[model samples]
Target chain A: MSDQKEERGLRELYDQDPERADYLAFGRKTETDRRGFLKGAGLTAMMLAVGGAIPFARNMPSGLIPSALADTPEDFTLFGKTGIIIRNDRPVNLETPAPLLDPDVTPIENFFVRNNGGVPEATADPEAWTLTIDGEVDNPLQLTLAQLQSDFETVTLRMQLECGGNGRAGFNPSPRGNQWAIGAVGNGEWTGCRLRDVLQQAGLKSSAVYTGHYGADPHLSGEPGRPSISRGVPIDKALEPHTLLVWGMNGEPLPLIHGGPLRVVAAGWPGSCSQKWLTRIWVRDQEHDGPGMTGLSYRMPRNPVPPGAEVPHEDMVVMGPMPVKSVITFPDTLTDVRADEAFEVRGHAWAGEHEVQAMHVSYDFGATWVEAELEPPTNRYDWQRWRARITLPAAGYYEIWARATDDTGVMQPAVVPGWNPRGYGNNSQHRIALNAA
Target chain B: MRGRKLRTGLACACLGLMMAGGASGQTSDFGGLPAGPGQLETFGNCTACHSTMIITQQNFSRRTWDEVLTWMVEDQGMWEMPSETRQIVLDYLVTHFGPES
Candidate 1:
């Protein structure tokens, strides 16, 4: 059958019954190909032709879906075109489907996207983009991207950057901000100069206490004077070996959506601290009160609070390294497994600045736990891969849970952590249900 | 070989969408929100900067919605909504995606 005829046939099928089109397109009933062949060789050819047009077929449903559905950018790497839950679009906020995550470093494409404000109108010229270091520094320096490469030593390390409110959806009241589930966190290899090296070149003053970060994304309201977000980290955290002024992600130039021509990879802290489209690093003599630092933006109560209790800003402490956490990246929740088969459960675990000392898996909802094989981290801030195998005794349904302990002796809580108004740092045990039938 | 894999992937996606049984695109219209008195107005205003999915996904109470609106205006630089329109949207949101309890 001619390809054009095949294409026409497929298009006609789509135009008629979208449901049937979906069924055929997905090849769910491939066993009935003989029946389709009976219709004609054209139909069979069209099925084969659909493979070559996968990219096109993936988008064909857009025309059929209601126009109220927003259009995703064609070029940006998406975890899954249909799997991700987009929370916003101006400063794009996309959540990752937990299942799409890679057990190792998250590829730039699968990495969850979180933007504070609208994307910059102008694309940065890597050669011309400059970063300025000023404020309490003895010698303010303005260095272009080219100079940043030539003047400093470059290093690469695998690190995890997680939004403070990553699992905020678990909050009982369901916090007011972006309600991410598990995909708001990712581990990636970052290539850049150490933030300390850049600060050293500028000669930090003894009084320097914090480093304010400035990025190029504009405010959502289109205000020129106010940036969308301009947060900072403590000077000590800025000087940590893993804190980087990175231009590369997963061995490629940082994607603009994930912050590029320049951004800070402030490892072990809330992703907000790692400013994107970073243009300037201003050393401050006092704690910097930039865009997201005030009140309870990223702060949590120093002591646990009642799930619904409110705490004033003074009683809240600035968010630091995240608590110990683990997420199952394999066998996704609710997957069907063969009864009596020993299946491997795999996941990734990380603890803020501390190492993931151990991981425990429970098959009977938390009644009993067994140690999972924990793989050592590849780098200082990298997540540790872990796995455990279990054979179902009988076929029914089962819930698998994973909990990790940090070097600091902090273990994942069985229930959601102390809830704040914003619902930050919810390092609760991760669980997935599967049917054995 | 890659072409075959791509075809299989597309086929799987189609089956998955069929099983889910709704809009087949990456995003949904109005995020499956039910049409209401202020649906259009809410969509027009809230979606100016984001998808309607953002509004539909939240389960905040009326009080929390008010606070969120305040934060968006004061900190996130969202323009202040006129009181009447604001009331309409708030009522619509509270009624539709209000506190889960």
Candidate 2:
């Protein structure tokens, strides 16, 4: 498709001034700066086309205009073009309902999207934005995108970025959290300045224990009014060798919705702490208290609750990396046997920070366990991919479940604990039904 | 505010027209029985972060709705509201969205 036509089409469609549609859609292709305009417009359209295709493919039910201008009560809720559908935030038992894609990469187009507030509209220029680092630093610095790119020794790392609520649907009596599907994750090569390098340049003092990062997006109606989703990283994690102030993702500039211009890649930290649209960082002697930090939401129960109960105050634990779990992405059928004699069973497994020590597969729903080959961990913090093959024990219906244990000995629960108010931490054994011929 | 009023009027007019086309045949899952079509209004409030499919797909009793609201407030981190506002939200759900008993 002609990039110019696509850009003109989008501009005409979304342009606030309805009359601008004619100008954008059919205006005389002006001779002035036409080449540069087409070039830039082409790039923007390419980005939007890829980004927009995602919602239609999997994010939600198609065609949801952002809440910024949704006219009616119904329009406010539904994105008109995308197939993504939202549910009333309530607690219920959620099962991971879809097949996974590749074991290593969760494609951006397929990654599940879960935001406390609605996804913000894309910005025109993230590079023009600035990052302000202050608080307990020898030098409080304000740096721009170009400056960040050129100032420090840059680094790249392959990491998995997952929302804290990535597996909320796996819980029973699902808690009220961002009702995300399996798509709330992505594997990307994040490139940027190491946060530790930046901190060393600023010269962190001994008293600095916690660091806070802020983003540029305004707190809007859809999110929690007070606690915007920002969090603190311990000085050590902040200064970890691979911790990054990322600008590029998957070999390109970061997309606006994914925290363009700048965002933190705190590999393995809950998606909560990798602040998007990051604009500021503070080194504090004590813990910080932003809404994303000690907010009433996002806290996990100190202990598991029954099927229908609340977490007592003393039992509240902060939410973190998803529990170790796996899923079957192929042959998501109950009984239709495949004629292909070789039935390959494969899926993805991830641990928050610990290495996936082992993955056990059960053809008979935990009655017997078999060893599955493991893909090396993505990073110390990211999840890893795993695969295995099984010979059909005669053409028959079969149930498959996979579980993983981290180095810390955390095993997937066969049955999830009771639901809490905020749905968090749903690391249950994932089961799928299939038939072999 | 004027824009909202005008939009509201226009929406009500559209809904009235949809209803006049024999409300009997339209909107299948919801009962034709009287309790009022508060579905649109309830949807407007619930979808800030959530999708309406959450409610449409659910089969729950009023007690479950009450339990859900409590869970929304306590677990999902929704801001607590006055007892009266809570009652209005609950009544709306129970009246328009009671489970099939």
For model 1, what is the C-alpha lDDT against the true structure?
A: 0.74
> What's the C-alpha lDDT at position A34 in model 2?
22
Cα lDDT tens digits for candidate 1, A62-108? 22321111122222122222345455443467766777775597866
DockQ of 2: 0.08
Candidate 2: stretches off by over 4 Å: A1-100, A222-227, A312-315, A333-335, A338-340, A417-419, B1-86, B94-101
Q: Per-residue alpha-carbon lDDT of model 2 for B1-101, expressed as tens digits?
A: 22644544444443344335422211322211224555444554554434443554443456668877775665455667568767776777776555442
- In candidate 1 the C-alpha lDDT for residue B67 amounts to 80
Per-residue lDDT of candidate 2, residues A382-428 (tens digit) = 55667777766777778888888888988888876446656665667
Worst 10 residues of 2 chain A by lDDT: A75-84
Query: Model 2: how far is A74 from its true place, Å?
Result: 24
TM-score of chain A of each: 0.82, 0.74
Error of 1 at A186 (Å): 1.0
On the 0 to 100 scale, the lDDT of residue B50 in model 1 is: 55
Per-residue CA lDDT of candidate 1, range B1-101, in tens? Answer: 23566556656566456446644443334434468888876877776665454665578878888887787777776778899999998888898888741
lDDT of 1 at A63: 23
Q: Give the lDDT of residue B17 in candidate 2.
A: 46
